[model samples]
Target: MEWFLFQLFRTELIHREHPSSPMRSTAQQTSSEIFLAAVKRGAKRRARLSQKILAAGKIFSTPIASGNGEYLIDLSFGSPPQKASAIVDTGSDLIWVQCLPCQSCYTAIRAKFDPTKSSSYAAGLPYQSCNTSCQYNYMYGDDSSTSGALSFDSITIRTSTITNVAFGCGHRNLGTFAGAGGLMGLGQGPLSLISQAGAITSKIFSYCLVPLGINKTSPMYIGDSAAAGSDIAYTPLLNNIVNPSFYYVGLTGISVAGKAVNYPAGTFSIDTSGQGGFILDSGTTLTYLNTAAFTAVVAREAPRRPTLPWCFISLVWISPSLPLPPENIFVAVDTLGSDCLAMAASTGFSILGNIQQQNHWIVHGIVNKQVGFKTENIETI
Candidate 1:
């Protein structure tokens, strides 16, 4: 049987042994928790970016803190193939998993990668060298870091076994990543999976993350399967000369309740200096805007005193008492203590996070240098 190399969904915590698990009753509240965590994580990422801008005069890819990205993918590694779950992040490079002989590592939900058990383990690939024994130390904005040996081994995703896959075998790992074992680099970097497997993926990838709480599965597609239909809205992908590893998108403006909130032109533009502009980060749970842009958006959205509807069990109903616009289901104020739209008070750049990207077919077209978005339903996807 040929395992088609397409469509991996978010890993559910309740049922790890079964592939099909029904969305739990507390899914809506769980979604809110995830969103709030993403907001906090995004702020940390912004701080790190600001520091890089001030010190190095250029930006670089940084590992997102835990609770930022919500997408979870499952794959296997080594000769016998140890199954593991990883956070899918488009902002950071370096696909890594906790390895054996851990010096200081967080507890993983699954078994750690053991190179000795793998027959195809190689001493080196391009970035991960086994011969000379390369080491990678990646520090996050939150002060958490991962240090490990860089090496090569075969990785299996579905039916496809990608050979000579370069990845980090983390021995010293710490942070708030509670359930996930490691990270899968979907970013636009040399060490990222997309770049490493460019010959097979053809520089294309797409994903439709099913809204949190929904029982449906979200699928990630690579290569020709990532193409979008004509109805999808497209924007050109901007180049960040300072950090070529990130996927920058041109964000003209934002609309609330069908009204355009005006901000200065080039508020989200990236000039030759490699500053400003927005990124489409699957790892970030909430959308983030620069101070000026965020303030303007909040002013426009705060005035609406509408009631938001929520679903309980399998039924959806309107909650007239809730003080939020129907369109902004994820928005919260004061009592709920979560931002319907998060603000980036710490950084100059804006981010189009995954919260705003829910129930949408998001495409990353490297060859075309464009990103496309199309509204979708979880059931249909």
Candidate 2:
């Protein structure tokens, strides 16, 4: 579980790769075409996730907005290290992969992971209710699901290997996974990779998200190596009893171009029932604000022409303020330089998404109950 660095690629870019080539070519499409396509897909993903958050209320369940992840990583599982790709998701818990003997599976997957081929694979757990093997079933909001035996095995990322890792060997997987082998859950839950390997990771990790259009892989650091440096800015990490897996933050206020936007108090606060709050999620592509706050921000910033090169939107997190440049707040809609707001209004809760996180070294300091941020040129890492 020693801290290690691994490459993270956009899912769309990976899909565009030719079966015989490792190079992730865009199939000759222009950068604008790829960016616009990603934006449209992100809009669909946002709508699905918003629906689940609004309807779930206090009822908690592992919900995967499958096939819509913005980023993915390549890793290996079991002995001999059979290569596999998984979606890196901070919104849900439970690491899983499609196993052999799949009753129903997505045809897009290159190959099914056969647990029997690995010598280190083990089934069942002490807490499992089954007499012989542990069984797991996860249902998503979009009617996608994976169900199979709960087991443990060796997982390798780069040169770092961790043994006896808990994961679900999915025998029945049905969904639009977009050719991914499975999902790597980075949430704050017992089944998440971070929690399962907490002894080594110290429940801490950090990542630098690159833009979707960029073909270069981004870097992800885990364990002690992810510790924030002196230049990092820290903010309180709130806990939600209703949904403990999510990483919640304190969003106090917002300002556009140094001008404060008037919004009602507690607009971003998690209520006693855990109804509304602000969360930082890597799986979500675009940022989402609560209806009231979203309206205020749009009304304040919308008057400016979209062609402007500068739009500094600062998000006040308790005592610290994180300013987002125009590139992070606005997305290109056409080659003519017309841009659109890269955020949406949410009826349930607000989320700081990946688009708003590019080029920033974000550290999730779980043990200390605080998240840290440091601006850096991630491509140089």
Candidate 3:
């Protein structure tokens, strides 16, 4: 099997809809699964955001896509190489998978990795002093959790085979990861796949998420392979002091119908304290803004409309012939025949979700701490 230390792979989103038809039913179930996973991820993020705010003045100033469905890619671990598909997530760190001798686990579509079978599997990590046997336990917003031992083994990605790569050998696992074996977290944390890749990957990656229901392969590139051209627009990646794990971007203002809306300046500012800003998250399905900004945008986008959902519906009736704002700022939900962007109001921070990121080339330059966006269709090409 060929693999790259840093490789590029194509992925597709799954949808489950229409119970009458078998294919459609499967797609519908997949869609529901994706939606539920996204909701749980959103709730988890919101709770973390709230925790950061509550701990602000005190000692604990803390913490805190691509497709309408989950983004998955194939990877292998161990010496003999137990190959399995894993979800590519940017919201959380720590790449983990269910291992064999399972005490309890979800109904997996692939064979689980057995550390005992791999000749290169090391039961303990050198980083530990006394209890070198690595172990981890994590819980998510949807009440799902996983507990397992850490293993240092050979991991193969295409043509590149890396040794001593640390990953979780999950024994007790649960949650929405049914069709996939585990999650490959690409978040900006210490334990993420990107971070673990270390000098081999050059701290860079890029992805182009296909729209929902598009049965095509979307691509993800690592290292120098993620090049860009002049047609791409670049945005400065901002830092959220409280939540360094997220990819924050400066969102100056939003415009509608080719004219700037009447929202205040500091609406999306990142001050010294890292309060009030927006982040681009691939795990989230819908864009979200502060309640104030969301309300104003809704009012202007559909004036005389009382509620947000109603306003969105009203936009569908508006003449498409009318010129609209640039897509990077305002996204039109064509599936609903509506000009309204699929965004909502939040109390903590604004989020640029995968819904708005569709069909765009998103480059994450972790080394430079900047993110670049370009509008293009890599799927068809």
Candidate 4:
């Protein structure tokens, strides 16, 4: 069997609708289970996101894509490798954990960063030469602004002992990221733990996740030659975007209340970096929509809800019904609201997140410029 590690993030902030409800129903459970069972085949998935990040409690945080963050990972650093609470992200790839000296390591309720701890502590960091020698000064807005110089140390998870995790050490405070310790930049570069490991040797790095929206049945796939479904649905990649080596997916179509509205048929882009709004990002924290897209979805979802309100949480919203089951999924919410109900608009459902992609097999063909989306049993491609 192959080896991998799971990492978790302690997310405390979210932008969700304000309404509350009882626990998910058995019917919902049945649906979720059916969807997830098909997605999870022979792989194990770990937690990869923070527990406190969701506005509507853990449910909203369920099926988190990239917004859930890297709560777990494949045993790259070499340690037994902790469990994951992940948000399968793609915009970037540099798996790491919050270490000690964590001035602002996410919410206090979540895991605290302790540098003094980790038996694998390898220090002698140079913080000043970051932007010039490192990536950039601007971390993503969604990321916890604890920016600083990137570290060139070896971190070992269990499955594959990754050296030079591309992990960043924080400054005295969060210069950019809101209040998080450090981040695990997971893309296709040295920043990626797997990719970095691959650099040292010739091993390829990859990963996957199990979705809660799928009733904790489906397993998202990463690394190796692992993939879930056959009769999958895939959309072609757009003409232009950022990095071609990115774990890019495709934009199938965007609908408003079951009505298909064309955004030029090829306007969507997939980013594992966990950047951007709701239109194409599966790994983002919130389901942000462009003005036109948001308007259309909201109008269809909550026709009766008020247009503008004082607080973002007080709005009524329509939950989107999915054609596919959950699993093979990642959920998203509003700006950073603590309530999922508030983020809902007149759209048939909230932004299509981990909830809609349930039971579907998704593939981030990093080497290719396309994503493969497939139903567990039905091969769309």
Off by over 4 Å in 1: 1-34, 52-68, 126-131, 225-230, 307-346
In terms of lDDT, the best-performing candidate is 2
Candidate 2 achieves a global lDDT of 0.76
TM-score of 2: 0.89
lDDT at residue 319 of model 4 (Cα atoms):
23
Regions of candidate 3 where Cα sits further than 4 Å from its true position = 1-69, 225-230, 270-275, 303-340
User: Model 2 off-target regions past 4 Å?
Assistant: 1-28, 57-67, 225-229
The 10-residue segment of model 3 with minimum total lDDT is 314-323
Model 2, residue 270: distance off in Å is: 0.8
lDDT per residue (tens digit) for residues 1-381 in model 3 = 444555444333332222211113243344434444555555565655455543555673234211112456667888888887776777667778889889999876678888889999886567655246777877654456778887788877655676777788899987656457787788777777777765677667777776654565566766653554455455566666655767877666665544555666677766666566777777666677888878887777665333433222211101111111234333433446344455778765677777567767787877777777776764554
Point out the higher-scoring one by lDDT: 1 or 3.
1
Report the C-alpha lDDT of model 1 over 53-151, residue by residue, as the tens digit: 333343456444333345667788887788887767777778988888889988767888878888987655554334668888887667777889888
lDDT of each: 0.64, 0.76, 0.63, 0.34
Can you write out model 4's per-residue Cα lDDT over 224-330, one digit (the tens) per residue? 32434344444443332333224433334454424564443223333343332223233332333334555654555454234323212111112212243211212
* Pairs in steric clash, model 1: 69-283, 123-130, 331-340
Q: How would the candidate models be sorted by TM-score, starting from the highest?
A: 2, 1, 3, 4
Q: 1 or 2: which has the higher TM-score?
A: 2
Please rank every candidate by lDDT, starting with the best: 2, 1, 3, 4
